[model samples]
Target: MFKGNFIQNLPKIYGTYTGGFLAFIILMAIAENAGVSKETIGILFVAFTVCIYAIIGYLSRTVQVDAYYVAGRQVPTVFNGMATAADWMSGASFVAMAGGIYFGGYTYMAFLIGWTGGYVLVSSLLAPYLRKFGCYTVPDFIGTRYGGNLARFCAVVVLALASFTYVTAQINATGTIASRALQIPFELGVWVGLVSILLCSMLGGMRAVTWTQVAQYIVLIIAYLIPVFWISSSGNYGIFPHLMLGDEVAKLGELEATFGLKENSKEAMAAMTFADGSPVKGLKYIVNSHAGVPDGAMAAWKFISLVICMMVGTASLPHILMRYFTTPSVKAARKSVAWSLFFIALLYTSAPMLATVSKLSLMDPSLATGIIGKSIAEVQSIDWYQAWNAQKWMHIQDFDNDGKLALNEFFMRGDIVVLATPEIAGLPYVISGLVAAGGMAAAMSTADGLILAIANALSHDIYFKIIDPKADVRKRLLVARALLVVIGAAGAFVASMKLTSILGAVAWAFDFAMSGLFFPLVLGVWWKRATRQGAIAGMIAGLGSGTIYLYMVKFAENANENIILGIDHLRFGIIGASVCFVVMVVVSLMTPEPDKATQDMIDEVRVPSGKTVLGKQH
Candidate 1:
């Protein structure tokens, strides 16, 4: 028993997917009685997963050094796109966004658009230039640009805050998916996942996490796509990626005869208390849109915020920028971004369609009512509500004072979309197990990367770079390992709290990066006259504006009616980005640019090797 417990604590490290695959085995055993077919597709998915991890680990041995931090600066544009796809498609994509789309209607597309388009901005505006700088972290760029240690220190703080917040949130998302899909305790789910992240991250730094991400990318995309295939094929139209409501409608009409749909689920109503002291009014929703959700996909300002966060945040992210360093040249960096985007688009474009189709099916009367519903219930009774009741999550309330279940309340959560897919489309039990493991993979991939980044920044950027430049690389790496332990422990504690609003936390992180660094980096590269004063002022304004707004939304106990304005954390980041850009321009106009050496460096970053730029090249 002791050995088993210890081994579980330190997940086996063999294949590239050691942690995730083992967890997959554990999930399969638990799901053995989930009433799924438990055959062919499951074996195929598991085999694909193992191969993915092996390929990544085998190749990553070639990835070493500070250059590896930037992906050797040799990564082709296409691979970079694939890598970036892996980077951005974290736990959020694996679970949350699709669910949000299902629940929020077309409005959720605004978030997707923002996330996807942001990469375009990053690749075009910032990623290539930063790659040329040969910097290890975001603060490295700031330190050199400002010629001030203070600026570098500040960047570290913001980076730590933004990243840890995002990491913790991803773990929470993993727990949410596991709890719903496997009926596991949320805290146990988080701990089981976090251990995997710690092992890989603590081993090879960014090198380990990068390879792991590649493995996770395959699993995540597979888990997502397979279910869509099942659902589409199960429908009548034979239209792939297209929904046919014919079967669903017929099914629903029958269910309505008994266990009728309540006007609005009481569970959903209980979740809201409006300004007028009345419950938010709306009909109950089964798959995605529950009562009291934002009426549209997104508002205009919200849209703007999403774009800025996704685009700017990706470009400046320390770990992502770290990948470019692994590439061999500026051209490679450019090419890599293209590949990452292509791979990412595979699932991103499909997400909305999947959400829409999923909502239609889950809410179909036949499935939600009599016989089919009874079958779903029988399948669900294995571990039963007894295990779930202790978790105190997934409430089922009777609305209209009726004795029957509301069922609609489950749809409102953002992670439920993927968790319900295998079961809903009538796929095998192994798919459910695979998805649960996949969720862990997504969470671990991001969590370990973030943790390692925090550790590396402390040892490499601060202790070694600034405080003690003479420190040996090995010792520096050791220091980094120590920090990883701290970060992992902290993230686990935060995840165990069962904190909701992961999407909100992620937005705050993007805002922090955008508000504080976007303008400084943007102007530093483009404007020869961008002085230290301008960068400082712009950063302050951007970060300050965003921070105040976040406090109002997340912390303030009693808030104003402006809450109805729909300005979330993402919107706040955009406002802050604007302020920073304006302040930088105004200050630059009042002062002179960096000296000739700095200006020359800027010119150098813009020109790719073997290409002549008129009289440029410093």
Candidate 2:
């Protein structure tokens, strides 16, 4: 009865929590107006939010294996949907997505379309079936379905590599937010963020991560929407920014022409100069073309290829698939996907508005923006410029030996767009702190799910399934907690090295998952003839080909020359996935059919209303 009431009251419970959170924000706004220091507000936002997540984790901590691994498979549909959306909206989505749209223009909409379309594929192809399978991890399904330790081991390898790469991007985003909010070194900020992430997932695992992520989604969506609405309401773009996006884009194009910021234009690519008249080394600022593509000849191919990779990769991601396993029923899993898409759409639809307004804040010719065409010293005197410059995230220089700033002379990292938009638009300091908190929530929420996915794969699939099948619940939970700390620390270390931009790293991770896991997982469910040997061969072939292509494009000299048939680093997954599908089909056809029991298992998974196939056996 208690459980039933709690499940029934979920809407009211989360509704009240949302109201309280908004009230807290109002109180902070009051404090800000009352002469509170910006530093104090920033610190308070981060400290307060992290404490709340930690407390949720402590309350949700469990000794039972089922609770730790699958949240006891009793999560209601709506809350599970919220958790999945928070898990999906990583730092890349919250912090860098708008930046992508700002710089790359409509060409970057591939991410938006591809990611959202991926959910449609999830609901149809993967989510319901996976939930009915009753597995704890992706590897468990591969191992069980294919009837071998080797197939499962391969799945675990892919899950860890892809997840670790993705998690580093999340940690990097956290570091970016923490460094700005707390005024600390990026290296130190990575560790600080890691500690907070650990507190949210280490004890309670998926159980803790689910509830904490729900809270995070609330904070993040509110944080994301407020600034856009604030900017719109201030008479910049009118009351509905989304409706005004077309007009704003037209305005932006005119401004680009006035500033000579066209794609690949000579003026846009001119060398920059420091205030001392020395050349700024290795810098170029290219604005999006009117069509939002760098090269018109290959735009369609690149766009389609990217969309396919993102969609396939979305279906194959192990952490996302794990979310379905926590739903109460297969019906709930399907509903959860619908809800996840709705929640994700809220932020995604607003991103273009934020991107346009942010660009306008700097480039609007009618405004009193003294920075453009102004002397270097004069631009340096701007408060927002000085603040971002001190953080080393923005740079300005004169390339023409002119005493003024050019539109092309200014440069900022794309990762900072969402975080810096509040200040760039002349919003209050409290809004900036709110944006910082939102960015932290986005990064930390995804990090918790990702780190748990990796640790769970290792502890449950590798340590228990393969190494010690007799391991008790307590020991398994202990291993999972310890692995979470180690894997998280490694992610922080890699993040500190700053291998690439947050979006770039995330794309690479998606490609890796697509290359290695997509065909194997998909065919395993849809085709009963898929043998262990075929699955293993396909995983190796696809991942191996994708990795080699990525290495050549990223590390080889004259990397541009290595791009074959216009497939760049981001689109390599198309080739990889195609190769995997063909290889798996051919190999499966050549091998003997699976035994009767295995075929029956596949038949059972197709039916939606049966008891979980492996729920009690293990």
lDDT of 2 at 210: 92
Model 2 lDDT per residue over 221-289, tens place: 999999999987774577888886677778878777778873444544454444455554333243674
Worst 10 residues of 1 by lDDT: 609-618
Q: Which candidate is the best by lDDT?
A: 2
Deviation in angstroms for 293 in model 2? Answer: 5.9
In TM-score terms, which candidate is top? 2
Relative to the unseen true structure, what is the C-alpha lDDT of residue 114 in candidate 1, on a scale of 0 to 100? 70
Angstrom error at residue 387, model 2: 1.9
Model 1, residue 78: C-alpha shift (Å)? 4.1
Candidate 2 runs further than 4 Å off: 1-5, 262-286, 290-297, 369-378, 402-404
